[model samples]
Target: MLIILILPLLKANHPDFMNMATKAVKRAFLVALIPLLLFLSESTTGFIHKLPWFDIFLTSLDMSYKLDIFPTVFLPVALFVTWNILEYSLWYMAQDPNQQKFIKYLLIFLLTMIILVTSGNLITLFLGWEGVGIMSFLLISWYFSRNDAVVAAMQAVLYNRIGDIGFLMAFCWLISYSGSISLDFALATTAKSTTLPLVGFILAAASKSAQFGLHPWLASAMEGPTPVSALLHSSTMVVAGIYLLIRTQPLLGLNDTALTTCLCLGAISTAFAATAALTQNDIKKIVAYSTSSQLGLMMVAIGLNLPHLAMFHICTHAFFKAMLFMCSGIIIHSLNDEQDIRKMGGLQHHLPLTTTCVSIGSLALMGTPFLAGFYSKDAIIEAMNTSYVNFTALLLTLIAVSFTAVYSLRLMYFTSLKYPRHNVIINFDELSTPVFKTITRLCLGSIFAGWLILHFFLPSNDITHTMPPHIKMTALLITLLAFIIAFDLAKFHWTKEPKNKITSKQFSTNFYPIIIHRSVTTLTMNFSWNLTSHILDLLLLKALMPDLLKITQLPPMLMVRLSQSGLIKLYISALLITLFLAMIPTILL
Candidate 1:
């Protein structure tokens, strides 16, 4: 772990060191990751060696420590994060001129991945947790030369920190309430009590996960690179929030109020993001909001006490959302970084593979039949039918269901569909455009992989056996309705509809709930940002360059004050006399 972490930093700062040192450092980071990979691979293959066909995957599970569940969340994420690190390192080392500018981002990226997946306790989680916040700040400032990038990156960090503070409080509360930060210990304790710390834990989980008010930051995060968006949406920033909820599921039984709040917030965030996404002109932003909204739905799934369904949705969402982000990246690259979907069209012929992958991703997003998203999205809403609380959740999910369709298709249409305009220029001048197609294949593989796992092997877990089929059927029906809505939207002529103009009031009408989330965000910006630095400056009261002149050449009032040294002698005499008097009194006593 130490070497794995160090190599990235060395590579990042390589230029400052000697020439040979740079090569050695770069090689060092790569070599370190290799050992971990070999060990894990050997262990897995050895354990599963005797099992037939597909049972081999299950055979490997026995090797893992029981404190940490294997193949479920941690191991997969760790392997993936390591892959991200190696990819980042290679990209950075290649010094592709264009990529060189963002090389320093490698360290932050890999560190975040390591800290998160290997986190054994809440504190460790926070370490990986906050690493993301810091890395986000750095990457956001990647194009620091741009005023937009700097401000946007700062906004991303500031907003996420507000959520991080909640995580910190929850971590502290966990230690106080449960006597340990271990996920098992805390869950065990939570399974026993109805207490305030449980409430704190819930708020922390909800806020960090982008529940309701904390949701806007995810949309703004599109200001960073598309790869960042893919990772962020898939397994890092956004996932951290949901992971906390899953990790703390044991304590959830202790407080119904906390769970209800999470449920309401999740519902509101989903509806809010979906509505907001519908009005977005920026393709990435539309997808960004959609990711947040989808995450909100997953939160609700967990809140409704359906974690297996939530986990299923999380897996499928990861597939489609990552594909969507990567595809959006391709479209943006093809159009010379033009993110406005309105400015994009006819890219289906230009980037056919990317277009195809995005279409599959979109189908998955809409929960169309036979797709990865279909099975999971259906299960969650269907599972909602089992109880009163769940029934309300089911209703909200259905009403909001079509919003996914509306925005998901709207996103694909503007970017890939043929919308004729008087003067439009589409540029495909970059290699990343084709490289993005490969990413799409990767995404499709993930989506298809899920279907294979579920259809053939049957997704095994603690709860799949007990779940009712009708509930799954109900979810499937809602998903089907959503797909129909997306298809209908796709058939419409959006370009011919008047001005091609989007309005603040109109967009806000759609985005109002999520945007209102911005007010607290605005107030927070003032405190952490505007008012905060102001307060810090007041505290520091440092001398500036201008003050150097003032000190050398005093103002008239200061000259007069300098001349008045008469009080200095008088003060010294008084001190001496007081000391003498005290000494005499002590001597006499």
Candidate 2:
């Protein structure tokens, strides 16, 4: 079945029948994936006691290369990937000449993520980790002609490489202490031995997941195609860090420092990103910052020692996040690539379906009641309230949640409710059949996947269902308050200049993490170059070379002057010296 899905991709470059064939292939693949998902879910339930759904082993240097799939994590990821692939085939890239190449890159990206998530050993995990990094660099730079795309791709690679160092450090510690890189072996070690690796793992998660200090790349990643944004943000690349920490939850549980670190990093990132999202005008960037905020919450869940909650949130976030990006894609496409929300208004009058889907996604994002986000997000917040972790983290998380509602509603108000501000008069309606089907399917998931996953897969005991009514109602109440505040704020026309221009610009610029990062890097490079030039180039090479050369050339200069002089005695003396030196070797022999 997988082979059938991939065969059409190989011939996707043939212009004669490529379009229809690829579309049909994508639909067929989606159809085929349904039964497979159902079968996996049923088997997982029936054989819940059985460990590791599937495994592969290959022997090299007496080490086993193993792959294992845990249904709870892999199922939601598979579903999201399937939907993303279908959406990629829609009208978004229908006119691009390199559509086939883009599709291939997306498939390869998905395959690498699957490998990473299902990896049973550290070596396999590293391979998958590097694979995704490389593929992301390629996909994010898909529009190679654009300077922003190229820069975004480079930024992603450099940031992820920093995380890769952590992964490598962790692997080295595992190999040295445990004599094996297998997850099972690493887990069996003493806490003292695992603490350093856990620290490394946290660093890896921070970099890949875009924690507070390491998050500028995610916002810049909007330079890519929207489908890339959807898949990259939703399930595959950004979440890999959180997934790693979740996979190592048992190890994380044994360490206090690591958990505290996760808590601080997550809390800071969530609050920072949510605040940044509120002041953004670009449609895609608003969603991108929201993704960073959600990932931060996932980290918070990990810190609270509730990996199950984090995993549950990952599953739920994937659906609506992807839907949100696709909806944004449709809007931007319809507007001939206009991305500023200030220029977009009253979309509901023209593209009602797209507007409705975007609203659903935003609501899910803000943790509305019974939606996909509410199930997981509310649980995480509840856990935060009940846990004995940092007080500051809890406060930041709650504030970030309220900020989430504010930004989400604010986004909808400017794009859907206000009078049309865009100059384009084109009638933007529902796109093709594939677009409709993809959006509808994701909308359903955004509504129900969270509840389904929570009820079926996640342990109910972990959720603090018996909390006080005030605590239980905190997220809902905060969301409602935020909606009211945001509505009031929305009444003002966006065209009017803000009174606090500098503050507004700072928030819109993501608090200038990108600026700080570039400034630091530039200063460091300039300092190093200056030091090298002064010490090595000027002092050693330039200052000493003339004297050394003059000293070395003195004998040659004297010989040449003597030869050029109109003096037979000098020539005879030089000839006698040469003959004497030449005869010395013969005499010694």
Candidate 3:
């Protein structure tokens, strides 16, 4: 584990060496994981006990870590990181001059997430949390020359700072009430003391996962390189919040208010983002909104007291979501960075394999039958239906699930099935060996990884939902109905009618979240400027400093004026006065 953390720093200044270092780190993680998986495959419990050094490492640092869940979560995360790195090298950053630096950043980002997932103590978790946040800012604003990229990076950082406030509040509360930073200790706290921190954790998770009101940054984050998008959305930064809630499920399960809050937020976000995605033209933003939507479903699972299902979804979502982004990258890169789907068409003929992989990813995302998403997503929906919680949240989630299908199909229609829309007559094909292989591996995982992990890795008891056949089939039914709607919608031309344009515009602009965020930000900045520049600097500091200075210098000015007077008697008298004062002190002594 230490080697995985430290290996990325070796010879990082040299680009060539850094490339090799990343490859070596990937191998090191695989080597470390193989043994853990072997042990886990034998027995989930007591596997950590067998590894004496693991305990010693934790003891040396004087920090607690969740050993059992760590390996399970880390397996998928490690695989995703490895695949993302491979994609980063092959297609996304192939032409970039500073690809090596990007690779190093990605490795460090992976390490921080590792730190976060394994953390049993709040301090360690915070360290990892802040590390990922900083790395995200760097990676998102990679195209420093681009104004949008920089603004997007700033937006992400600022929104996450709000989440951090909640995180810190939870940390302080845990330490104050429990007298220990250990998550295990927090779990044992009374309901009265734990409720506030649980709320804090939910707030933090909402912001980090882009739930509802805190979701604009997720869409804006598309300005970054696609690989960064893949990594951030798939397994690292955004999922950090979901993982936090998953790790603290025991506490959350005890708090009714917190769980309800989560359910509401998740339901609203899933619906909002899915609706917005239906109108978006940017390929990456569509996928970004899909991510937010999926994250909301995960939150819904947590809210329904099904955190293991949330973890299950996270693991499955990572594979196809990463593949989707990478497939989008291939298209965007091929088209000279054109992200507007409206300008793209008939890509299935031009790039068959890439389009096929994208179709597979989209299908998996929509929770089509037997795909990776089907297992986890279907389970979540079923659980929501059977849940005795808010019926409104369940309704919103079901609507969002249908909307998920609509948008996914709409995306496929525009990018794959429609007639050619671009003026460029360039030949598009999946000829790159590395790109083909990378996506192919993910494609296979999209097909079978969910079943493999569900049967072998995940605890079966946690995911078992005994719902009626009709309720269980609701997700599939809604998805199919959405497909028919999408087919009918696709029959029309790309241009919108007069009445529809306004609604489309709203959805495409993320229903004014971006506008609202910008307006609020501008108002805050203007208010701050007025307070500082006009009130403090101009009125208070400028107005008072001169008077204060004059008051301080009055006695000195009088003394100087007296000494410089033209009258000899005044000077002589001043000199005599000085000598008299000096003699008086000596006499007193």
Alpha-carbon local distance difference test for all models: 0.62, 0.80, 0.81
In terms of lDDT, model 2 sits at 0.80
Tell me the TM-score of model 1: 0.72
How high is the lDDT of residue 109 in model 3?
A: 82
For residues 175-218, write the lDDT of model 2, one tens digit per residue: 77776557766767746435788888888888889888778889
Model 3 is weakest, by summed lDDT over 10 consecutive residues, at: 46-55
TM-score of each: 0.72, 0.84, 0.85
Between candidates 1 and 2, the one scoring higher on TM-score is: 2
- On lDDT, the leading prediction is 3
CA error at residue 200 for candidate 3, angstroms: 1.5
In terms of lDDT, the poorest run of 10 residues in model 1 is 45-54
Number of the top TM-score candidate: 3
lDDT of 1 at 395: 63
lDDT of 3: 0.81
What's the distance in Å from true for residue 494, model 1?
1.5
Which residue pairs collide, candidate 1? 209-241, 378-475, 382-471
